[model samples]
Target: MSQLAQDRGISVDHGTAEDLPLTTNEIDLAALLGVIGYVNDLEMVFSELARVVSPDGHAIVPFCGQMVLFAELYDTAAGQEAYPDTLDWKETYPLEMAKKATWRDVEAVVSELQSVGFTEITTVKTLTQPIETAIETVESPSKGHDDGSWIVVHARRE
Candidate 1:
C-alpha cells in the first residue's frame, strides 16, 4: 500500500489509527474512505481522526458487497441462504480470509462516528455503481436486496 501511495505521490506513512503520527489540529481534511471494514476499534480511529483534523474538517468512511463489492465482504445474514434476494456470485477467495476479517455495515460506521462526538455528520451520496441501475434508488432496496451497500460518511469535527 505504501509503495502504491508513494508511486502516486501521496505522502503515505505507516502508523496505528489509535496513535497517529501527527500534531493536534493540524490537518484540514482527512479522507478516511473504507477504513472501518478493517479496524475493530472504530472509536479510537475516529478519536484520532478528530484529534488530527481541523474543527471543520471531515472524514469519508463501510458494507454490504451487493452495493459495494470492492471489499469482498462476506456476511452470513447477507448470504443467498439467508437473503433469498441476494445475487448469485461465486467465491473469489479462500474461505479462511472471510473467516478472519470482521465485516461491518454502514450502520456500525455511523454509530462509531456518533460515539466519537461527530455532530455535523451526513452520509455522502451512496453510489452502488455497475450493480444498481442509474435510475434505481438505494434508499428503497429491491427484493432480496439491502440498501446502503456502501457508505462514505462525511463527518464534521464539531
Candidate 2:
C-alpha cells in the first residue's frame, strides 16, 4: 500500500513500534483513522503513538463500537452459535465487525489511549439517530433499516 501511495508521489516511512525508524517527536500528526480496531493490541499502538508524537501533536483515531445494531443483530442471531466468541466472529464476519462501531466501546478506546498518555480528547458523533426514526427517514425505495451509527474521535498526545 505504501508503494502504491509512493507511486502516486507520496513519501512513506515504514517501521515497527519496537524500532520506529522515524526520529523521536518528528511526527506532527498521526491519523489512526478507521484502523485501530483491526489491531490485536490497541493499547500498545497508543503507547507507540505517545512515544512517536510530539507534545500537542494530534492523533485522529476512528474506531467502531460493539453496541452497533448490526453487532446486536449478530449477537442475537446464529452468530452466537456460529462463533460463540467475539474473536471468532471478528475473523469470520469482518465486514460486520467493521460496521459495528459503537459509542461505549469507542469511549473505552479513548480511555485506553488516555491511559497510554494521549490527552485532549475530542469526539465527533456522526450518523446518529433513533433506530425507529432512521428506519422511517431513510429514502431508499429498495429497502429500509436502521443499522445504528458511527463516530470519529480526535485526540492528541501530550
Candidate 3:
C-alpha cells in the first residue's frame, strides 16, 4: 500500500501509533481505521496523535467492539458443528487477530481521546449486524454507539 501511494507521488512514512515519524503539530488529520484493537497502548498512541496533530486538527478512528468477536466465535462454532468433517476447521486470520486484540468499548475509547486533549468528540455507530450472517451487509450510520458492532469516532485536538 505504501508503494502504491508512493507511485502516485504521495509521501508515506512507516511508523507506529505510539511514535509517529513526523514533528509536533505537523499534520492536520489522522485516520486510524480498524487499528484501535491491534494497538498495544491506547494512551501512548493517543498521546502521539495529540502531539503530531495541529491545534483543532481531527482524528478519525474506527473500531469494532468485543461483541464482534463473540459473533465470529458463534459463527465458527456453528460452522464446525454443521459441517463436521466437511469443513476445513482451520483457524483463520481474522479469528487469530481477534484473539490477539485488546478489546475496548466505546466509552473507554472516548475517555482516552479526551485525556489526550481532544475535544468535540463524536461517535457514529455504523455497520449494524444483529447476528453474524453468511452474507455481509452494511446499514446506514446512526448517531450513537447503541446498536452497531462497528463505530467511527471523530475527535478534534485541543
lDDT of each: 0.59, 0.61, 0.77
- Each prediction's total of clashing residue pairs, residues at least 3 apart in sequence or on different chains, is 2, 3, 0
Cα-based lDDT at residue 3, candidate 1: 98
Give RMSD to native, each candidate: 6.5, 7.9, 4.3
lDDT string for model 1 (1-158, tens) is 89998999999768877788889988877876545556778788888988998887776663333334533434443342232244343433344444445556665667777887676666543434543242243453322214445555667777
TM-score of 3: 0.81
- Show where candidate 2 strays beyond 4 Å: 15-21, 73-104, 130-148
lDDT of 2: 0.61
TM-score of each: 0.63, 0.64, 0.81
Pick out the ten consecutive residues of candidate 3 with the lowest summed lDDT: 83-92
Q: What is the Cα root-mean-square deviation between model 2 and the actual structure?
A: 7.9
Predicted model with the maximum lDDT: 3
Point out the higher-scoring one by lDDT: 1 or 2.
2
**Model 1, residue pairs in steric clash:** 63-105, 85-144
Best by TM-score, which number?
Answer: 3
Model 1 score (lDDT): 0.59
